[model samples]
Target: MDEILDVVSLVLILIGALLCLTAAIGLVRFRDVPSRLHAATKPQVLGMILICLAIALSLRSWPVVAFLVPIVLIQLATAPLSAHMVGRQAYRNGTIDRASLHVDELAGSSETPPAAGG
Candidate 1:
């Protein structure tokens, strides 16, 4: 059982590391701001979750796991919100490529205030 737990932890840790690396590579490889933001946030969140899981499994401490739960929740809550804000800001500032977007609900929504004097 101990060996199994160790193996599981190692696997999770390795997978998390790979995800982080993939996110890093994507940040560099993706050209558009939205795409880069996707690359930066999505895998990073998953990686963090996986890493937290590995830590919980390895420590096998309920207190430590309890401490980590809120951290995981915070990451889950914030990462997407942060990515959306960044993506929206980039789109508004004309930093993102319009051609890359397939569906632009934001472009058609009243949520985006119109430009002054336009």
Candidate 2:
């Protein structure tokens, strides 16, 4: 059972690493802030979860997992929210490319730039 769990943990870690690699690739391929944010958030949260799970498994005990639970919980809750907030701010600020987006709720509603009138 312990060996089986170890193999599962290793697989999870590998999958998590693969997700991170995908996110890295996405950082180059994605043309805009929201798209890049989408790529980065999931992999980061999942990677941390897998890493913690791996640590818990390697210990082969429950006590370590208990400690890990809050960490994962905090990340799971906050990571996506933070990513969304950042993406929203970038969109609002017009930092993201318009061409990369298929639909933007705030599109065309961006604040007008102030004139340099004396």
TM-score of each: 0.88, 0.76
Specify the poorest-scoring 10-residue window by lDDT in model 1: 109-118
Residue 61 displacement in candidate 2 (angstroms): 2.2
| Per-residue lDDT of model 1, residues 59-118, tens digit only | 999999999999999998998899988888787777877777798777765345666443
**How do the residues 61-118 of candidate 2 rate in per-residue lDDT, one tens digit apiece?**
7878889999999988998899988886797776988677777777665674577231
Best by lDDT: 1
Candidate 1 collision pairs: none
lDDT of each: 0.88, 0.82
Error of 1 at 98 (Å): 1.4
